[model samples]
Structure formats: structure tokens, C-alpha cells
Target: MPDDTVCDMWEVQRGFDELGRPLRDITFCVVDLETTGASVKAGDRITEIGAVKVRGGEVLAEFQTFVDPGTPVPPEITALTGITDRLLYGAPRIESALPTFLEFAHGTVLVAHNAPFDTGFLKHACADAGWAWPKFEVVDTAVLARRVLSRDEAPNCRLGTLARLFQTETTPNHRALEDARATVEVLHGLFSRIGGLGVQTLEELQAYSAKVTDAQRRKRGLADRLPDKPGVYLFRDDRDRVLYVGMSRNLRRRVRTYFTSSEKRSKMGQMVNLAHHVQGIECATDTEAAIRELRLIAEHAPRFNRRSRRQRRLHYVVLTQEPWPRLSIVRRLPRGEPGIGPFGRKELALAALEAIQETFPVRTCTDRFGRVPTRSRCLAADLGTCLAPCEGSVTPETYAALIRRVSEAMTVGAVDVVDALSRRMTIESDLERFEVAATHRDRLSAFSTAAMRSSRLTSIRTCPELIAARRCDDGRWQVHVIRYGRLAAAGVIPVDASAPAYVEALRALAESTDERDERTTVEESETLLRWLESPGVRLVDVVGAWACPVIVDPGGPLVELAG
Candidate 1:
């Protein structure tokens, strides 16, 4: 739990998350390099380095140096840069010059026109000198010009072209210092254009030069009020409808990305266009933020969110309560009934049901049976897949025993079903029926997944209430109160707070629950279980038994079910 490991499970937008700092507060090291050749891999090396550090349109410092390449300068390179072997007679080598440049630009954002060429050469120099390259935030002026200036404003992003367009006092002449000076002017000119589009921070400036649509960029003000903390955010339309919901460790940084090119999803772009405002809900911990996100998404069923919206479609495989028990696929399982799932897909539940039926001599037909059973039998009986209970071939007592086995396979353990399917797969494979073996493998996978999920969910659902705490990266304890697998309350224990008193207060503030049916969704229970079982988590207190049955394997050994 490193301090920087915030929201490890969530996907974060790539780039700097420093959106709070204004562009005027950022010191930029505008750098340019003259190289011996185009490709660094072709034994080319830096001939000269020129950089000007500026902040708020004020020049702070300038760095210029010539590096000896340890070889004769190419004739064409001399023609382009006007530097030759004679001019480099007393220059410092890269090993000496690289450290000085690095020290000069150590804490500033690196800016360059055609950044990759300049930064790539610097990185190569750092590597050759056995120095770890510092991770500097980079802004490319050429890239920004392409994003901000149209062809009518600037014919090309080349240094000479942009210099002429901006009427820069210093013009680029293929020399490092002069080109870098010219780029400073071009950079300022481009920043002014983006400033009108609401790009005010270094992070926003970098994102504005990306593939973000102009329409999306214009809505940057929507993220202005968000706090830089762990929380959930909601995007709302003009009619106050929630278009999307999400959570992040840094709310401001994450929400800001929605209007940037980093959010590449086309549906998100449409959602952003429709969005008129964004709302933030600050939380005490990342876990709390995640749970809040799930609850919000479930509550609103936001159009742009793809998950947790179709809980109604979740299916389960249950043993039907009837005169003659049979495995059935169901949308909802009765309370106190032994069932296998809350499978997200009906096809998956069906596959688990098929696997159970294949393993046991249970009735697959959907018809209800009475004491005086019908004489007619389904095709399964003819195919010898069923015991033909309708024909009175198997006694009621015997059928009940088989039903118990099926229930056990679904509820207590699935080793029997796994063993049966595995044996069949072996026989099918031995007979060279690879495709048939593959089908058996798939069914086994479905059954095992359902059984594992059911076991995990049942363990948490049966518990009355549990309080768990884990030490955070900052040495504070994150405490959560869970009631019947639902997150009831979450709070943090300060470094100086009393642990028992803090937890007791948190528990008192938790949501109260009655002894009713499991109220938490399967997804929420699974999420809580994962957090509870994660490393370094300690169970502070438990009101009831909170443990899952060991999953047994077919090879005569028991194994703990992985979270």
C-alpha cells in the first residue's frame, strides 16, 4: 500500500494528473537539440543543447552547451547546423553536459517543438551516461499547433512556419539556441489560442493537443468545482438526467479527462456533449468511493454506464421444489433454497444446469409430477440421460437421494459434478472426440464459476455484520462496516485516533438492517468479499459466522476457493 498506489483496481487516464496548478504557475523548460543525424540508432549524437526556462511569459534562465560527439561531424550536419569539428574542439562531452542540462530542467515541465526528436535524444544521452532518465512532464508545441491552429492560421507546424505566423522576434536558423528562442514565442502564441478554449493547466494543455473534439474541450468548465479527492462523479444532461457515473481516487483529475482526448469512447463523447453539469460525492476512502459508484449506478441506471444496470437479467440454477425435484434455471431463487448462482448471463446459468443434469440422473423436463406419475417420458429418458421416473423405473426415495446430491453439488461443494465431467472429458478425449471434450470442459468451467460465486456470496450474506480495518499507505486505518454483505458505513481512523473508540462510533453510525432476505446485490457482496480477503485486512469484529466452505478438487484434495 504505497502512498501513490491510489485506486489500484480502477483504470486511470494516462498523463499527469496535476490539474490544480494554473499554466502561469508552471515553469517550462523549452528545449531544442542539434543532432549529428536523424536517427539516434545510427550512431548519431547530440551536437548542441539550447533551453530557455520561462514562467508567466517571463524568462527565468537559459542553458546552452555544445557536446563533443567523439567523432568527426558529418559534412551535411555542419551545413544544416553551421557547427563543425573546429567549433566543437573544446566542448564538453555528453557525460559532462547531460548532468548540467538535467540539473537545469530538473523540476520544470519539458517543452519542445517536435518533442519526440528532442526528448528521445536526451533519453539516449542519459542511458549512454548510465543515468536514470527523470520522468519529466512533456508538452510538444508542434502537436499543440496542429490542434489549435488551422491551415489558414499556420501552413505547417515547422519552426520556421510557426515563427513567421506568430511574428517571433527570433527566427529558427537550424541552430539550437535560436530555434529554442523562436519556439518559446510559438509556444506562447499557441497557449493563447488554447486559453480561449478553457485550457488553463499544464495537464489540460497537454490533453488539448490530443485527439479530443473541440466540442468536448469547450465543456472543460464542468470540472471546475470538483475536489481533488477520492469520490464518485455524475455527468448530468440539460434535463437533469444522469448520463454517466464513475469513481476515482482523484475526482478532479478523473473528471477532467472526460473532456480530454484520453476519454476515447465514442459513447462518452456523445454523453459529454449532452452533459450540462457534473456532480461530485467525496468519500473517505477508495473502497468507499467504489461502493458509492456502484450504488449510484444501480440507482440511476445511467445510459452511458454498461455494468450493474442489468441486475434483473441475472439468472440462477436452482433445484425446483416439487414432488419430483429437478434442476431449473431461474431468475430469482426462493429464500432458504439451495441455489448455485446469480449468473450475469442466462446462457451461463443454463450451461451450469446442463452440467448438473449431465452428472446426476435428475429429470431435465419441465413438467411437474404427482404421486401417480404420467406414463409418458421425454426424449431424455429415451436417450438414457434420465432415469425415467415417469415410468416408475426409479423409486421416489431413490430420486430424492439423487436430488440431494444435485443440491449439494450446487450449494455445499461441486467436486462430484467436476469429477463426473472431468472423467467424461477424459473418455471423450481418448476416443479422439476433441470437440466433445471441449464442450464438457466449457460446462465444467461454468458450473465451477457459479458454485464459487454462490459460495462467496452466501458467506457474506449470512453474516449479520462485520467490521474490518486495513492500514492505509499514510499509516491511517480505513474501517468499513458491512451489514449482510452491503457496505453500511465507511470511515478512516486518524493516526492519532483511538482504534476501538473510532470503530465503535463508526459502527453506531452504520445503516441498520433487519433479519430479512439478503439485501446486497451479488456484485456488491463479491466486491466486499474481495476487499475483506485482500492482504493486510484485519477483521475487527464479526456478529456471526463469516467463512466459506473449502472447495474440493476431483483429485482427492481440498483447496481454498480463491477470491
Candidate 2:
């Protein structure tokens, strides 16, 4: 309040106002410290403190003091900071200096280049002096610079580099007051840079860099309007092109995560930079939201979504149309042929095929010699691994039965073949035929994985109306309504909600779902089963019979039928 004070150049206003206080109206204490060393844990001490209290881009007050560190300054520290021992001969100790600085910075956000370095020393000083440091909000200009400036503009977010880049009126000279003055200029530069990004509030400023802080923060306004409900969200570029598509149980919460530190994918950061807006489509249930997400991703083919961008080219293990129906991998299901899979990988399907061949004497020959052929048997027949229908060695009806068993192995579960392979592997390994044992082991693993995956898909596929419920943390049941393998609806019913009422509601929801016999994506089926199989989930109701021919064990292959 002194008339001769340098801060008299501008009027200082305190407290929030209508229309929310503009960033320019907010007060900030730009601070800097000259320390004897880089770390306080190593007994480093502040030799000098400097802070400039500013509002509306003009200085309101100034605070500066030299502190007697109670130890001689290191020669390197004096060289770096330009604060010699003589300079601090009559300085007040940190205990006294802190109170004066705190008074000047009262009711203001503290800012500094690399804030933690300065704030850490301040907090340590206060605690050492047996005083509680007031919980003042601190902002780091370095973090702001990283968000605002490109690496090309400033190679690093060093205070000196930023001061030079911004061409501040005062140059930092290793002196607290001068460096603080320079930081004040850098702070204003950052504020001006981020203002266009719509960071108008103190809270937004504090959270600016924590989220999509770069030019991507400009899209922060887009997420603000999203409804806080289950929905599909699309991140669109400047031309209104979708950059990414996603689904969330809570639209607002999920969309906001992209802009926050929780989003760690490197490509996501780049995606956000290209995104100019976020659009949300609210759904009646999480199940519907997820389905919508898949459809949107497929439609838009957004460059950012890694999965479900295209209709997957699924591989199926099918019986080769021959006298002896040998197992083979095919990209599409052959008409009128029973097969197992839409397996994601051909190699896996082949492994499943190999396992069936190893277990059953179903011929491995790629010939359609129905009943008999003039040609002789191949290597597989010579090894007795094939029934050799081509040579009239096995009847077509008998080979059909072997093919039927392989189909059963893929659809219901590979229990028989997997068990046989395990015994074979054990015997071979015990005899030290390690190579043969290893082949059996690999085939067993591949067959089990593919068969179980296909079985889960089939289980869901068979259900015309499926309702699964999982217990939420709050004792509510999160129910999913799945019709014809696609998620139709989802809802959370309170534990206290009457069971009759809940079932009736579910019935109504299920009836409203449009049923289609479309092939479900492997990912879609897997996601639903994962949630259903989670520890506390239960099958609440089934309009159509819901059954899995195999019991899924988290630790092993399909053990048995889920009776």
C-alpha cells in the first residue's frame, strides 16, 4: 500500500467476479530462488528469493530477500548464481525471509520456471522452521512452455531458453529478482499463448498441461458439451473428419480422459492434435454404446482406432471337401459345411487343424478322391497318420465320422484331442524326443486357444436374448442385454430395486431389441464374455436358452461343459 512502491504502476484487484475472472484479472506471484545446490535433500539452501506479484499483466508488488544459509556458499554455486558469501553476510535467515515473501504472495497463484525446484526449497525451508506452508496453488512455466511452444521454437523448456525465445524486457542474470522478472514475462507469454485454447479459469490453467496440453487443448471446449451418459464419441479433425471413435459407459468422463494425463498412447497425442471437435452420441445403455462404437469405427475408418476399423478377415478350420474330410484353414466358411472359427490368425487355425490330424486318422491329403483313386497314398498315409480314402483304405461314411469329431472339437471344445495331445507330449518328453514333444505342446496350446475362442463366440451367437449382470462396486447390478450376439442394451439396477421389477424391466428392454443373425466380431464377443465371466457377474435372465457347451477356466483350456 506504499505510494513509492514500484507496483503502484497498476491497480490490483482480488477475488473472483461474474463471467468468471479473466486470466488477465488473476494475480500471480512469479517467483525465483538462488540456491546453493540443486537439491534440498542434500542440505541445499536458498541464498536469495525473488517474486513479482502481478495482475492484468502489470506489477502489483515486489518481494525480494537474501537468506543466510548458515553455511558457506559452494564455489560452483557462487559462479552459477553470482551470489558470493559476502553478499549474504547480513541477510535474514530463511525463517524470517519466508514470512515476508508469503505476505507479498498472499491470495495469489505462485509461478516459477521449473516450479518444483523453487517450491521444494520453499516447503523445506518452512518445515525446517517449524511452519506449515500455506497450500498456495503453484504453476510451472516450464510445463506451460512445453505445452505452448514447439521443440523447434525452444529446444528445451529451460528458463533461460524461454526468456530468450520470448525476448523478455529483463534478462535472467543468475540473480533472484532479475530471473523472477524474466519469468514474469515468460508467464505472460504462456498465458497469451494458451488463452486461445480457452483456458479462462484458474482450475483450467492448473490442469492445462495435465491433459491434451498442446494445440490439442483448443478442443477442450468440444468435450465440455458432451452428455455425461453412456455413449459413442468421435474425435473429428478441422474438416469435420473423424480422427478416432470410441465408446464409453460415461461419455463425459471417457472423452475427458483423452485430454488428461491418463491418455499415454503416443499416437493419441498426435490424434488429439489433429482433432478439432468431439461429437457424442448418447445411448440408452452401455451395450448399445459399444455396438454403436464398432459401427462408427467401421463406417468412418478413423485413422486412430487400432481395432475394428475393418471387417476382420477371419480364418476358419474346415473339413476339406474330400472322401476323407481332412481339416484345413479357410478364409471363409464353405456353404453347408460345419466348421469352427472365425479365428483371427491363419496360423492358429492351422495349428488347430494339425492337432486334429495328429489325434484322428482323418487323412491329411489335399485330394477330393471320393471313395477311391488310382493314385497311391502320400507320405501321411505311409506314416499311418491318414486313413487314405484315396486308396479305398477307409470308407467315405467312416471318414465323415472322423470329420464330425474334428468339428465337435472346434465347436463344443477340443477336450478329446487336447487330452490326447497332452498324453502324447508327456510320453514323448519322457522319452527325450524333445522336438516331437515341443511340436505337440505348441499344437495343443494353439488348438485350445482357437477352440475356446470359437466356443465363446458360438455360445454368444446361439443366444437370441441374453441378459448378463455383474455386481458393481456400489452393490448395483450392471446388466447387459445382448440379442443375437450383439450388445442391445445395458443398465444399472440398484441392489434395492425389486427383483420382479428388475426382471420385468429387462424383459421389456430385451423385447425392444432388434434381433439379427449377423456374425459377431471376435473382439465384440470376447469383450462381452470377459465382462460376463468376471468374478461377480451372473446370468440374470434368458429369453432364449443361454448355454456354453464348455466351461471356461481362466487358468486352463475348456475343462468341461457348463452344466
State which candidate has the highest lDDT: 1
lDDT of all predictions:
0.84, 0.75
Give the count of colliding residue pairs in each prediction. Answer: 0, 2
lDDT of 2 by residue, 173-252 (tens): 98999999999999988888877765666756766666455454555567878876778999988899989999886676
lDDT of 1 at 322: 87
lDDT of 1 by residue, 1-563 (tens): 33234323122223213435799999999999998999999999999999999999999999999999998999999998899999999999999999999999989999999999999999999998788999999999999899888899888889999999989999899988889999999999988887876678877787778887778768888887888888899999999999999998878778888988878888998899999999999998888888888888889999999985677798999888888888888888765688988888988888888888889888877777786678777788888889888878788899888888887777776767877888999999999999999988888888888888788887787789998877766556788999888899998775555666877899999998743645667777778888998998877788987885567666643323532
Off by over 4 Å in 1: 1-30, 34-47, 51-110, 116-137, 142-174, 178-205, 377-384, 514-519, 552-563
RMSD of 1: 6.9
Give me the candidate number with maximum TM-score.
Answer: 1
